[model samples]
Target: GGGGSTTVTTSTDTDLWKDIEAGVTKLLSPAGKVVVDKQSSNVLVTDLPKFLDRIASFLESVEGSVQRQVLIEARILEVTLTGEYQFGLDWGAITQAAALKGASTLSAGKILAQKFAPASGGFQIGVASTDFTALLSVLNSQGELKVISSPKLATLNNQTAVIRAGTDEVFFETRVLETPSLTGTQTSKTVNPRTVTIGVVLGITPQIGADGTVVLHIHPTVTEKRGEAKSAIGDTFPIIDVREADMIVRAREGQVVVIGGLMQEKRINNDSKVPLLGDLPGIGRLFSSTSQEVRKTELVVLLSPTVMVGKKVDEITSRELERLNKTKGRSPW
Candidate 1:
């Protein structure tokens, strides 16, 4: 045990090494020492044979080779209620129709119990990922459902996955400034072009435990460029609207969680007229008709997480990890 190297198998070398030295302090002799070589991913433990034997046994019990991966599937929707649903979406009826068979097992209580609208007491019911189609049918019957995005990605345990979809729209920012010139001070008007994305971004992090339970940290953001209007100073600018939410939930693999309660009202004007007659300043009223409509829409998100392992992990990576983690053995004399 004068000078030897032992590799960590379970957790990262840096994390395990930080606690190992203090944990075995009582067993250390004057010359005993344990150090980590992060570059080579090895832990060097130097001591007597008896002490080395104890360290070896401890490492054997604490370290193993089991790594997990996660697959995230997300669907974003916008629902516009009309006719019978003019007031708002009836989440209560939908939740009741699509019940989470073993709802008690999943921990989505407070997050799902949040109100979908100010006047409605409807709360979300737990739905298995596989059982969401039937629920979708029920939702369509309530309003006009629009699917905004469906993004999917895979990540290792304790890693974060980001899914983004949308486009960047151009705009102008104007500033009036006074500058010094060779003759005297001069007034200048400057126009700067700026861009903003009208799209959706979701940051999802999954932590899978050995028991097949997964804890998810979800953050979703969405922005829309509804229309354009003149600024106070007469500079034309685009009107933007944003809705976002952040939350954490726990559930077994393949469980579905729906996030809702975001609503927005949009105003649209419809004008119809005879081309030449409508343009006449004084008589346009005789040939032109104008109407306005207000639309109410709600944003809903559906997330489903599945714990991946072994062959499934390989399929996404397009390579086998078994060969990478294994190495030729070294004997301890």
Candidate 2:
């Protein structure tokens, strides 16, 4: 009882705790000792009661910080900007409002422009605020804004969360055997059919600060199979167009930051089939009807981050419930 040890078993990023061995040991008594067990991810600390108390407090703080979570509400928008604003979306419109002046209300980091779309170019971050009310109002008033997808999710600090919009394409790889005449002209090659995922995929890894500042590591990727390409030897393969970028930025709680500059032209296809007849492969077309839409639009992402601290979730739910009850003419909580 006079001398003892504490074992701290961690789940993720356990190696990081090992680096602070010196700092933790320094807080102990001269004779106190600490050792990190890599295999078990246990930190053994033998120290006096007073020093152990301090160490426990410190560890709790770090654990709380790391385990913190953030609820992210995202809206993907597409717009068509013309004339003088061809370079990109006019973030300058956001600065016009005195409340959102200086663009400090919005925040993001390193938004890149890709080659898939000619006008896909750079953008400014750090113009976020309570919500996207004003920003959307301004854009909507001037032009039409298409909301692509609205995804709401919660993730632990520094953990990755992915949101996808669109369809999954299934293509089979074919092994082609070609019989060439005496004069060798062309040959076939083995094809490995793979699962190809196409569409807009956004990946985010966010860290929430004590003061509610959210730092996000964002990766956006857009890919589509344009057509088929033929090799010199007559081998055929899918030609894919890919646009992707990685960036980091910071914003405040409930603030919606903007990620723009990705533009794309796509052919959206729709197919309708007759129950029994459409079940056949090659003959399916005879019983099916197909349609296509050609669209040219600029892609924009609106992301709002709300960190869960203390009893914030309860407060939010209470407010929401009260509002809902009022709408139905019921009593408040």
Q: Could you say which candidate leads in TM-score?
A: 2
What tens digits encode model 2's per-residue C-alpha lDDT throughout 1-333? 012111111124333454346446555556689987767767788876755766665555555555577788887777765555544566656545524533344334534422233324433344366466666766664446877677788787666888877556655556768787888856776867565556677888776654668878777777677888776656566677777766777777756777776656667798889998998989988999999965556677888898885322223334433443454533212
Query: Local error of candidate 2 at 4, Å?
Result: 57
Model 1 C-alpha lDDT versus the unseen true structure: 0.61
Off by over 4 Å in 2: 1-23, 37-41, 81-88, 97-126, 174-193, 230-236, 266-295, 310-333
Candidate 2 backbone clash number: 10
Point to the candidate with the largest lDDT: 2
TM agreement with the true structure for every prediction:
0.62, 0.63
Taken over the whole model, the C-alpha lDDT of each candidate is 0.61, 0.63
